[model samples]
Target: MGSNAPSSAAQLAARAELQGFVQVTDSRAPLYARLAVGLADDTEAVSLLAAAPASARIPVTLFAAIHDLLLADPSEPLAAWYPNLVATPRTDDPVPAARELCRRRRDDLLALVTTRVPQTNELGRSAVLLLALAALGDEMGPLALLDAGASAGINLIPDRLRVDYDGHQVGPGPLALTCGVRGKAKADRLPSAVPVVADRRGLDLRPVDLGDPEQVRWLEACVWPDQTDRFDRLRLAVAEVRRTGVVVQRGDVITDLPAALAQLRSGHPVVTTSWVLNYVGEDGQRAFSAVIDDLGRDRDLTVVNYEEPDLTPGLDWSAELATESLSVLRVLRWRAGERSVEYLATGHPHGYWFSWLD
Candidate 1:
């Protein structure tokens, strides 16, 4: 290979931004990431982070490998590196372990980070979706769900997770997920039971298979090392999936949606997505909307997304919370050439917490 490009200031700025994100929302993963970022200039870390292909979250994948190593062997060197991990967490500088892994497994690490997308189907995010479903409980009952970019389709089983809000609570499943309401969302709380989901299916370019150990291993690898709560929830969620697997197909969302829609068994059709539209360009986003619109010509369609306003048109509000920087989400219903938009909540990227708004 020719002379590799030098680390750029832009990449460093991004790393700084990511560090801030982890510092606020995460605990242990940030430590290892900080160490890796500090050492970026010395190695090809900057090049590796900056030169990522489409859908590949380089930083998440990079740390995921380190996290997996720690999980793979909860022993010295790696064991003490991340204290926040559920299996082994000890407060200590993980720089040495991170450096050693990067040095010894450079080629392997690069391959994992470059080839794979940071696909995480966290149980925490289910709260955000649940809140939206709660809001639409009366209007759409016994719902049929179609999730775009639904990796592993873990989220397709919303009814399986439990949520406890201020005055209302939903579900009593094995996960029993938790989410608190903030700001105006407190008033927007729904009835105890969200609209029961009739059936659910997901669309992904590369859908993960929980049956395959390799695929499941990659899913575990995508999780932040310190988020033991999510890790524990994911285990149950995966088990739930095994007991009742969801249908996640390998195809383009826009191209495959019509066919997928045709196969629905019953209930009103609702399309959902979160942290997905940002990856697509403006044209693709508009095309997706257009497809939904096309479908809306004859039948009713409901859409919801947690999205950054920069890419999603008509969603022109920012979170008042100065500390948190994440996508603003809302619920939309399209029918008879008309669309209705409503604010859902502002939340952490992983749905750790939600500030509900009307």
Candidate 2:
């Protein structure tokens, strides 16, 4: 019985994490919020979550796993409550049905929670990336984008998607992404036209293959079910990516930086990382910085990082910014062996909105 005490304690901790997630989640994602609340009190659910690696033992990962199952088979009773599955989600409690599914599909859920990592590949973030690219293009001319940790490389083609920045539109697209503009940034600041993409390449440890339905389903599962618009946009982005194939080399971003940079033949090389550094640890982040600095010795280079302020090293931005849900958009440029860092903007982690800083 004493040996079981540690496991029991771990379940309690995992349950607490779920309760906390419910507090911070957007009020609009009521279904997930409610599930988190219910799952917090479910012994079986908490135990399943506790079995996952400490880093993967989060409400989002667990919920996404369940979402993936539903996406594959929405015939379950709980599917009726998922907005992505049904046009009108029932208002009644979904916890009972959710619990039943967890009990019946324990082994499947366990496999997913233990192995899968959440990969949002949020297309909304394309707005943030596009803005940064345009700013760089104003000075650098055409740019070759090298995406670090670019899952499926959806962001590799932001110029191909239509982005409406408060009535200002960019891209000729199949997918339209909208970001609310705030603060001092002006639409006129963007280039008269979208930046010319000399080339686009991506480096990821495990890049998603758009051709695989299961792989694509996991990407969709990562999105909250209540955000139907995000789910729809993801579908459009996937179609666009399928139409224009992207090359995502399977390699570590830190060690493979130079090789990836070599693939770009012309135009300024711009490397972008979004929500990727958090997984790389502090040492990896430092190494990535070192690699960029080393490569910049002979030529001009730029790195645009959209990451949590604290997770991103070498920048002295306020600690307060890290505490907020917002992610910072920072641009680092190397000219003549000199490095300069600029804090460009702050925005929603998913890039639904942003407040630019001059």
Candidate 3:
């Protein structure tokens, strides 16, 4: 019989990655933490993860693939532990069930991780986006939004969704998002009115078609299994997008930006990128900046970036504020060929909360 076991080095690397994920994950997500610990020592599971591309070898991608499978077939024993799949998740140890599912569905899991990268248009971040938009509107009036790396363009509609920043509410829509405010930000500092989004467009290499059920399910699967609130919000946001359609064009952020910008005819153009520059590497990030700088020569423009501090180039504070755990929210603007930047706030990657800095 042919042996399919992974090499010792591969197994060691996978174990280290899973262990690191457990350490960094929020304490509330106990299920994933436990699952990662259990799978770290499992040779077969680690082997499957080893076969995936370097970028997709992390715990999030592995668990998301499993979650995708569970969403399709909730009959699996592992589904009992997932709050999204069960009315009341079982408190019993779920490692055995998870291992069994991994053993039985090894092929399926491998295919998913090999083919798909974890994609999330995290709606929670809209709270931060809304805040940024309010600041821009205060200075420049109504805005045109162009989202780079917009997975499903769901975030392109922050203006239509309600966000309660520690009791201060914004927006008049049905889907409500709660974001905790910290630091110098006060309730009165929030804009009295939500900024009007005159035009909204998104650029993604492969945009999710909400019209397709599978694509919708994939988006749902990307949510952490323990965060049931996020899952519920995602469903609501998806529905809102369906009711009122969005336009997400197929294109690259660097190459096709000018054409996409040309399509927007109203308001001052504001480019927004949330956790996207990291995927492009240092050179690509520099290239993207050059593109924006070149474009700003003829028109007044603004860029709002919610990304890892180290990954974003040209931001003066990126080196000083770099941290693995938080995302920095910064704004870059150009007028009459002169450039300026605003370091707005730093927050959780998912926008669960933020600490404002003047």
Clashing pairs in 2: none
How far is each candidate from the true structure, as Cα RMSD in Å? 4.6, 3.0, 2.7
Question: Which of candidates 1 and 2 reaches a greater TM-score?
Answer: 2
Report the error of model 2 at residue 240, Å. 1.3
lDDT of 3 by residue, 1-358 (tens): 1243346675667767887888877686889999998887777778777777886778888888889999999998899999888999999889899889889999999888888888888998888877788888888988999998888888888677788888888889777989898787666767566788899899999889899887888899999888899999999999987776778899998999989989998988999999888888777888889899999988899999888866665434545576534788888999988888887888888899998876
Query: In model 2, where do residues sit more than 4 Å from their true spots?
Result: 1-7, 315-325
lDDT of 2 at 325: 49
Question: Where is model 1 more than 4 Å wrong at Cα?
Answer: 1-29, 41-57, 84-88, 184-188, 314-326, 335-338
Tens-place lDDT digits, model 1, residues 226-262: 6667777787888897776688888777778888887
- Candidate lDDT (C-alpha), each: 0.69, 0.84, 0.84
**Distance from true location, Cα of 198 in model 2, Å:** 2.1
C-alpha-based local distance difference test score of model 3 = 0.84
Collision pairs in model 1: 83-89, 83-90, 185-356
Give the winner by lDDT: 1 or 2.
2
Cα lDDT tens digits, model 2, 1-358, are 2332325666878888888987788687899999998888787788888888887888888898899899999997889999889988899999999899889999989999899888878888888877788878878998999999999898888678777888887777667888888886576765355677889899999999888898898899999999999999889888887777788888999999899989988889999999998888877777888888898887899999888866665434455565544788888899998988887788988899898766
Q: Quickly count the clashes in candidate 1.
A: 3
Ranking by TM-score: 3, 2, 1
